[model samples]
Target: MADPTPLSVFDDLRAESDELDDAVAELGPERWALQTPASGWTVAHQIAHLAWTDHSALLAVTDEDGFRELVEKALAAPDSFVDEGAEEGARMPPAELLARWREGRTALDQALRAAPPGARIPWYGPPMSAASMATARLMETWAHGLDVADALGVTRPPTDRLRHIARLGFRTRDFAHVVHQVPVPADPFRVELAGPSGELWVFGPEDAPQRVTGPALDFCLLVTQRANRADLALRAEGPDADRWLDIAQAFAGPPGTGRPAKGDAR
Candidate 1:
């Protein structure tokens, strides 16, 4: 896989955001209010949550003290703060909500690009470099966009941009284990994914015994917890690679209770 610099990752961020914007723009009231696969979250909630986080990310990079204060206030509230914010934000007029999201993400992209070299930006979990932070934003947008797409019964065509998400999934292996309080694997796993554009994306040492190989899109969906491992065509060899597939989460935070198997309702 070709290395994606932070600057190149920003292009992916913009592209993903544009894709989501176009999707939401074609929706009407009924569709906007439709509940997504994420329990209790409507399509509106997903977009609202994306807008809210983009605004928050902008503040984190541009106004440290203010962002810190906001974070503190949010922490003082219940664990439902994020969800509550999304629910309330979703109540706005759809046009207004969409506009807010567009503006917020635009500002966030600017903030990230303009950040001084080597600057570390604070996040809910930890400070991240601009590239990592931008990739996280991409991952969130893609994951939430999947919810919206699923709610609409639409299939989002896979893209090579998924390389960023796949790389994040591999890079966050340790963080995933730590967040779940599972022992971090002493060994590393090799990830070899065929990108949507038919490019090969590889990670970890070539000699690693544990390996994951599959279509990049499937790997992205698996890591984001949007698709069940059993439903994907991904192949995992060795104990650690198989186990990681059971609990991989590209995003930071507690371990996610992943979606059920394809045919199961629960």
Candidate 2:
């Protein structure tokens, strides 16, 4: 299947970042420190991490030395870097964090816009073109924003713009294959996504028989392991369908242990 258009993905990244900024801005100080659904991070830490990450991502994309330096900085930061950053963040309040986040994001955006078409940039994993880097950032912000929302018992208004994040799920098939030590599937299967607004996104050949379908938010949560697939309405059809669902991953790096079983939520 053809890859997503670069401009579309870039637009999604900007929009998702802006939405997350708004959500963070709305939280009171006490709520910012509340523990999130993510195992080890609090709401404040999640926001701080976004700031730290965006800065790091920009360095990684622009200057090789700067990328290495940031990694060294992360290694040297206190064990509670997130907490420390959050503590510092609290002093400035949400408005400040939102400002910092936007400034860092703007720098990255400028760099991305300035890069020549097809120019490759260094990333934490494999090098990616500017377009891919922006898409990755979009996925990261959206996933982490979910953590913050879950902690506060707030639900983010789902947007069709998140199709970019959903598209990443399809691209990460290779990551899943490697994590499972299985050969990549040569025959493409149909991926039918039901967005939060009831919009459908179809990937792969029109005639491909296999199908995966569910609410876009649920699919994102499942793939990101923020929620269990059983909690979602997702379903698979066709011979190899179950297996694909079993190992689907939408991000770079290793496979996560799937979420606890349906009855085990605690």
Give per-residue CA lDDT, model 1, range 104-139, as digits (tens): 999999989999999999988889998888999999
Clashing pairs for model 1 are none
Candidates in order have lDDT scores of 0.90, 0.76
Angstrom error of the Cα, residue 99, model 1: value is: 0.9
RMSD of each: 1.2, 3.4
**Candidate 1: 10-residue stretch with minimal lDDT:** 73-82
Clashing pairs in 2: none
- Give the lDDT of residue 234 in candidate 1: 96
Off by over 4 Å in 1: none
Best of the candidates, TM-score: 1
| TM-score attained by model 1 | 0.97
lDDT per residue for candidate 2 within 1-266, as digits (tens), equals 23568877777888888887777777677887789876656787788777877887788767889888765655687355445655665456666777888899999988887889878887656789888888888888888898888888888887876677777777776677788887777677777887777778876687777767777777677667767776778888875655777787777655677667669946
